[model samples]
Target chain A: MYDEPYRWIEAVANRRQYLDDQFIHGSPLVGISCAQGVLLLTFNRGTEKIYEIYDRIALGGMGHPADLEKLRFTLLDMAHVEGFQRSPSDVTASRLLKNGLAPVIKPAFEEIMRAPYIVKILLVELGTSQDRDHLFTMDYDGMFAEQREFGVLSASSSSGDRLSAEWKSFGVVASLSSALEIGLRLWGVASLLQDSSTSPEVKIEEKDKPSSTSPSETPEEAEVTTRIREMLANETLECVLLDRESGKMETYRSLGQSDLQPLIPTEFQPAT
Target chain B: MGQQGDFLQVLGEQGYDVERVFSSHKVDALHASGMVTTGTTVLAMKYRDGVLVAGDRRATAGNVVMYDRTDKVLELDRYSILAIAGVPATAFEMARILEHSFKYYRRSQLQDLSFEGKLRALSTLLKNNAPAALSGTGTVVPIFAGYDLHDTCGKIFFYDILGAEFEAVEYAVSGSGSSTIRGIMFYLNRWSQRTMVELDEEEALTLVLRLMTSAAEFDSATGGIDTQAQLYPIVKGISAEGVRSIPVERLSQLFSEKVVNHV
Candidate 1:
């Protein structure tokens, strides 16, 4: 069904590298701020999508996956120390995600300084009531914006077109399964799959050549998308939830392929 | 003074005493009114799980006991504690500067400074104050102790007025009463050699308390524990669990049972 050679992704990968041209770069991160906690879900592109959470915070980030990994550990260390000195309540989601970004980013922006890479960080607070929880998107430039309901940040498209468009349809009362479903779909191999409802007449070949209306979807997009879905399907979907009952960050999760299989669309076919 | 003069250029424009303040080891108006005074005992020892650091609460002006509630022991991080025995202002300022610097490091690096790194930094601070140390008017000699995660044991570091750093195995003590307390610790170290690993928190705390009490017994400058003022030597432990102080209630108990009752 696919003309180009598909790059296979490993179920357990530590790093990811991206191609320069029009690519459905890495997977986009989708976050939904809930009434009790916030859910941040992203597809595993080539590198391992870093999902880190402790007591009252969960963070997921994209960009130079290596730099993202560094940023992740730094944030966790800062939050842990802050939680230790002050009450755990002092570690707010936005403060950790926003205020904490500068020190890591500024050093790279030294004398002849330029931001090293683009990194989008999503954070959610689990200790507060879901409404009080904060959802934030921070860029490498160290600018962050709070999102009330839902937000999706894509790396492939310059403006993250697909992600921004999909949030309107992502309901506020959407269940956890649907949040992950929408995320897997947007970053899924089927991203190039023509919406089954629209143009059932358009062949899979036309889907390869994305319409001009959509920002440059990766030209070799189908194979990329297919590999992303297959790689994601075999691995467990990582998640961090604040168990409303326990009032604690839920770190241990076993989200097997069986659990998320429903999110995989039938029309989606791996480009083997 | 030339408006465009560089620092050295400006010093030349002024007199030579200006240069003396800049490069020479001479304490002058740069120091506070009461900077180089000393007279207290602070000692630390390695135990089973961590190192115990402590300092007597007395502040002295020569032979006069000026204050009885000073806290000479400062916690640098979760894993390190510093006890100072020097000029009151200089000691407190050094501790304050260190604390602020560590907070900056923690906030920026997103991690605590390493034990060795902390020692180097303190050395740098003391090195900056070499003139005061040489003048003997604003000197600071400190004993730093902390848990070394890499070595899996408690360790101690000592500093001189010139900011020379030395790592001590087993135990270290500093201050006017150091000569007396060192003798006590050396004797205790020989007795405890039979089962060094068996030394626990209680034993470490009691040892530090005994050192401080005995130091004050003969030294008029180092005051003993004052229950009337609710002042006792400040004792802290640094381990994998991080730096924490022994509770005052427990300190009071140790003071009454070990020092007060024995006396």
Candidate 2:
């Protein structure tokens, strides 16, 4: 008798706590850099987490059900339905976000706003337009934050800060590898910080991390430095980008762990 | 709380026990007797760029012909195509639900369903109709094919009456003439020395017409392109571009020049 997505509403409400608990378990990450006619997203295959890859909208999810793959598809279908029934020209990013996306995600949001799932979407446009690409980071409550240039949503803030700085230095129209350079370094830093913080031997307070006066190669830092080199030396990267001339999105995989070695700066790698 | 308080009271008034509707029932072959009108001969295959799906135009009730111009093929979503071959009414309803669900899902998630995901959803719907299938009334099975953005190629899946799914490597067919159609495709693929992926969209369309015609020869229920009725089989293709039905004029030409004159 109930048809307005009420079928799942009751169940979603009952399992609200379970979903929230799962969201706190794993930390998935994505690095995005967009320029005047080009947008690029880099995913970390090293984590083996599920990611929601949909048409026109590829998002990185950090929460329960690792890959919110169905949600991504439903979102695309909603956009298509809005664009269709009316006219094909009606299919635009701005229109989809306003009329298609916002209204659709509202019901699920209201059901369990306290859930810990966080969604970061890189909205790529296939049509030729002068408008810029959009990066939207949404929390469980449907709060939307728009980012320009670059954005990183992860468990660690230090990594975000470092990535932001890299974005600034790379400038607009930076190649995909340049953006990946920033992501790889930040990924190493974040993982090491997490490992060190969780170690029983390290009892330092959060404020004194990477202590300014602690000098460069401490034993803990040395261990982190070694792990980064190993990961970089054997990492296989998966990258997707939106084509400018054809306006088509293409996904490609670059093999070899050392493939990215050239892009990683000397300072980030361990001394040979 | 909204409808919970009224459930027991309502059931009491209606003279029905709570277990009647909610709990499992032990019933045997007691619903509708046999299927009414049924559709036949739905075929789908993966080509180089995208998927090619086609279906016949006839609806049959045992020995009697119920309707012509019945479209058996349906577009499930922007990126997928469905060809139904079961109870005509249930098939139509299933198509409608599928179209709605895929659209609802994409909008809610802001993405297109994966090729495998679409197949799984269709299979779930079929499984849900188990009661109807058992009683022999609402049974529906269809061949699903579509372009997967992830794989960047065409993919096809078929389902049984029980709603179990089977993935087809090269081609798939359902209804009264599946074996006949399957053999024709196999022969052509072997003789022509072209892998399914090597065939262009146009060549794929022609092959589908030829196969449907051969299938119509054996299965009276299967409809071929009828020149007198000016009716053609429903044909559609899916590519990286999207799902689109092949125009009637082109189909008529192909039937006349390729299938009719040659065969």
Candidate 3:
């Protein structure tokens, strides 16, 4: 039996590349978006392997690939072993957050530093179970979070640091939508910085803009227009925000097309 | 005597008549009802994620509606639902009794009974009523549905008058309006592959109501949605969150939107 088991392990290792190839070719990204923000998560249950693409909510590294499977096991344990009669929804985010389990998976900030891609994470403790609780986020690495509101993760280390400093300047926004707007603004700025460093055209677009004020617009409108133009120039790097109030997660290609359009000047139209 | 025996005795004392109706006999009975005092339609279909149970609000006593506010559909638990047809009064009475018993059991035990347990209990109640129903009084038939968490998908069960149950793999329909509803469902089957998240609860309820409305329009025994009275067909969902009734306002909005689009 032992010899057979060893051979089985070797066979699996040898065929691992083929399995991975099959998964990579078969799986596709599934995303959800609405008025608030957008979330993109990948599913590859067929092979029992999982990976995290982008996460800013800080609930530990996108959790293990087997986390969901383990959660299902926990649910079965609760129902069968522990005799806890409760709906699966009752065992989720808001409940975990209320029980203060959000911080259990501490921010492994060092792991994030080694990653090639920038990371951002938001975590809300939903509730606790006798055995486990839940941590929900808008984006976890590449895993999609579908709850109405509670937490968000924004990308860009330098921009994130700057936004954290400026966050204190803005008054407390208790609503999820407001928090998402702030996060989107921070993400937009970070994306711009990232694009300017990698692309020559964005740098030229910034340099060509006139430093002097336009003659007709008010100061606020002019500022809004400039910001919109800057965002539009880096439209490929979109900013997503989650509005918990409406249960909508929306993605904005440029600030001009965002809900803040009323603040932008009429002359500054987003390029479709 | 035990409570079960007492229950059976009471059922026998009541002048209820129940008899097994095969598929051929059911069709004959449908013809005999003069198409007026027809059975209401009850339908349950299993989708990829969960079960969809539906029923029209119309109950006829000869040619007229016995009640407009009738809800012939019920969610028995988070993962289980039931739809009733046959004699309106008898079916409603049976439903209320079963609901009360389930609630009492839950409250007493401080835990929910399993889906199979619930079904077994219902079967017992129907079997006990066999003596009275064998006479000529009335009978109740129901279609039960649930999401078996262990199974990780939806399941549906249909019952005969004698309480003999059969599990339907895809779809099951019963009652006076069943043929029409089934006709509409057969056409909609092509799109049933879509995930539950892709279709909001509001949209799902509208689809059910549309099928019901279409059935009512063609079948004299089935009633169309009463917009003037603000009464709509009953729709419920059983998922990981438990059983929840769809809001009437949402149903009304969808109905209006569909009507506008059609016109």
lDDT value, residue B239 of candidate 3: 69
lDDT of 2 by residue, B217-250 (tens): 8998887778887888898988888888899889
The sequence of per-residue lDDT tens digits that candidate 3 reaches over residues A1-272 is 32476774665454433322222222222122322333232222333222111111112212233443333222222221111123323333333322322232222211232221122223322222111222344222223343332222322222334434445555554443444344444333333433333346644654676573322211232453455455445432222222223221111122223444453334544656
Output the lDDT of residue A198, model 3: 35
Winning candidate number (TM-score): 1
TM-score on alpha carbons, each prediction: 0.57, 0.47, 0.42
Instruction: Please say which candidate is ahead in TM-score: 1 or 3.
Output: 1
- Summed over model 1, clashes come to 6
**Which one is best on lDDT?**
1
Q: Which stretches of candidate 3 lie over 4 Å from their true place?
A: A1-272, B1-38, B131-136, B190-203
Q: Mark the regions of model 1 whose C-alpha exceeds 4 Å error after superposition.
A: A1-24, A27-60, A65-117, A122-135, A139-144, A148-272, B1-39, B60-69, B88-115, B191-198, B220-223
What do the candidate models score in CA lDDT, each in turn? 0.62, 0.60, 0.48
C-alpha positional error of residue B107 in candidate 1 after TM-score superposition, expressed in Å: 7.6
What is the DockQ of the complex in model 2?
0.07
Chain B TM, per prediction: 0.82, 0.83, 0.75
True contacts kept of each: 0.00, 0.14, 0.00
